[model samples]
Target: MHFNETELPGVGKKITFKNSEGIYTVMILHHNGKREFYYLEDDDDDEPLFSTTLTSEETKELAIKLLGSREDEPDDDSYDHMSLVRKKALVNWVEIKDHSCMIERSVGEAQQMAEEEVSIVAIFREDDLLSKPSDDVMIADGDTLMVLGRKKAVEQFENICKES
Candidate 1:
């Protein structure tokens, strides 16, 4: 698989992933939390064969379904597809312990402190979930960080969270 990403000025971003069969799946992430998906038969084609839009919530649900959690594992035949997806990206949860260095730090501050690039997609605090929290959001002890990034970056982030 091959992928390309382009910034869309004030709009958001455009990402296109080419599968083994040469078909392209394009995803446009809008700044307003809307997502547009398109399928292209040829790389040079300007018009998509199919297109659809999804809200942020719907996007999250679709991602969850694609990832298949431990409690809702897909059938064995879907393992290969799942494996491919896992190899390309990773979504993980890192719990902030009492000794964590991230405690009390704002999300923006913590992101700059780390050498690796991993996105803090959401923060789970007991009964509440702060999705796509602002930069000023503070990290608290026992809060679980929902992070997304490459495998190596995510691993490095987990290690950073363990440091006092």
Candidate 2:
């Protein structure tokens, strides 16, 4: 199974999962603690075959079940997609501290990520996740940024953020 994630701005994040059997599942996590689920027959289909919504608590329960308990014997079939993602790109969680160069600058001015081949995937602040942050979004002290890129580029970005 492969899952692709995208930011929906004012809405939330959208995650799509596809399996080799041509099955597709989409989950939209709203900022307001709601989740919408959709299913598609195949990639060519624009409309979902079925759709439903889940409350935040229900979603959490489902996630726990899917992840299983630590005691549960590891199954060979239970693969971790995060490891695959890490293999292809370096992901970092950087905190914007006092006096850091990133503190008050917008993403565009603070870090020209495209030129560096690095991408700021999300900003985590006060338990809220902002995915696909716009260039105008300003960084603030105490903000946690999630960035992705090749190792060297990611390190460069981190260095830029850490500068006083």
Candidate 3:
């Protein structure tokens, strides 16, 4: 997995190196938007602490290499149509905020929205982890909704929420 800029601190000081057999002499340094691996023990006195050439890809590769290769790197046959759907604009999306509506009529609105050829995939309560919310879900204050089916349906649903 690519570590985002936030996850890794792109900074370092000094440098040094020794390439010994059976042991890789390297550490990843990320600075600015660039990243790479480096030899921690090997540094010429002439070079500055901030000077080193390491790419994020190389660092990731060396790290993974230390952990051994994964046999499941190329496996993903679980969900049919998932690959294709992934290639297209994702149907799954979240509403920005929980807008109040008649709890009883919410489902009906969702249904009518669905009839317009859009589907109401799901509505999630706020504070949920966003992994997966269940069916028969209810909306409440601070709820985050997960909707799917079609773009048009989602837009219409939002519009109705705005109106109500």
Candidate 4:
């Protein structure tokens, strides 16, 4: 089959601009100043009313991919395009916290944990949720890292590193 006939990894095709669901496909704008794929919902009159799509995986996939990419890299990169988000690594929590640590090593520690096959899950900056954490994001005094890893790994990473 041709590319159009098959499921392309990072692409969304407008399926019947007008459907019974009253949905139209429109691109969603992002804060980074990028236009991503989205399925827009419309009415029989084509009066676009609402659209709904994911900014990130409800799980660990997109979050991890987001962490892996450089802050300035274009979102067009294939690595940045995946339909299913990675599941956060299984983990345990002894205490609740956000950042990795205080020292410069904290950054490294975060990477190490990420590399260790444990997912950072979701990060929180105050009340705002940081699903995709940037490398340069500062580890302030009040941040929370939702870690996903093995019970031991999560506990160690949280108690000894992320939370301390």
Global Cα RMSD, each model: 13.5, 11.4, 16.6, 14.9
Sliding window of 10 residues with minimal summed lDDT for model 3: 1-10
TM-score of each: 0.48, 0.46, 0.34, 0.34
lDDT of 3 by residue, 28-99 (tens): 332211234443333433233343453434544654677798544322342223323433322433344434
- Model 2 superposed RMSD (Cα): 11.4
Top candidate on TM-score is 1
Q: How much is the lDDT of residue 70 in candidate 4?
A: 42
For residues 1-164, write the lDDT of model 4, one tens digit per residue. 11112222222222324445655555433221223444445324333455444443322345457689546543433433322223223332122334445434443356475334555545665557776565565555555565555434554565566444
What C-alpha lDDT do the candidate models reach, one value each?
A: 0.77, 0.72, 0.41, 0.43
lDDT of 1: 0.77
lDDT minimum window of 10 residues, candidate 2: 76-85
Query: For candidate 1, lDDT tens digit of each residue in 99-136?
Result: 99999999988877768777888999988999999999
Clashing pairs in 1: none
Q: What is the lDDT of residue 5 in candidate 1?
A: 95
Q: Which candidate should be chosen as best, given lDDT against the real structure?
A: 1
Residue-level lDDT of model 2, residues 1-164, one tens digit each, is: 77899976444578999867777988877553458888899856777899888765676567768888545544333333322334366566677899787888887676584356877789998768999999899988899898877655776887877789
TM-score of 1: 0.48
Off by over 4 Å in 2: 1-87, 113-115
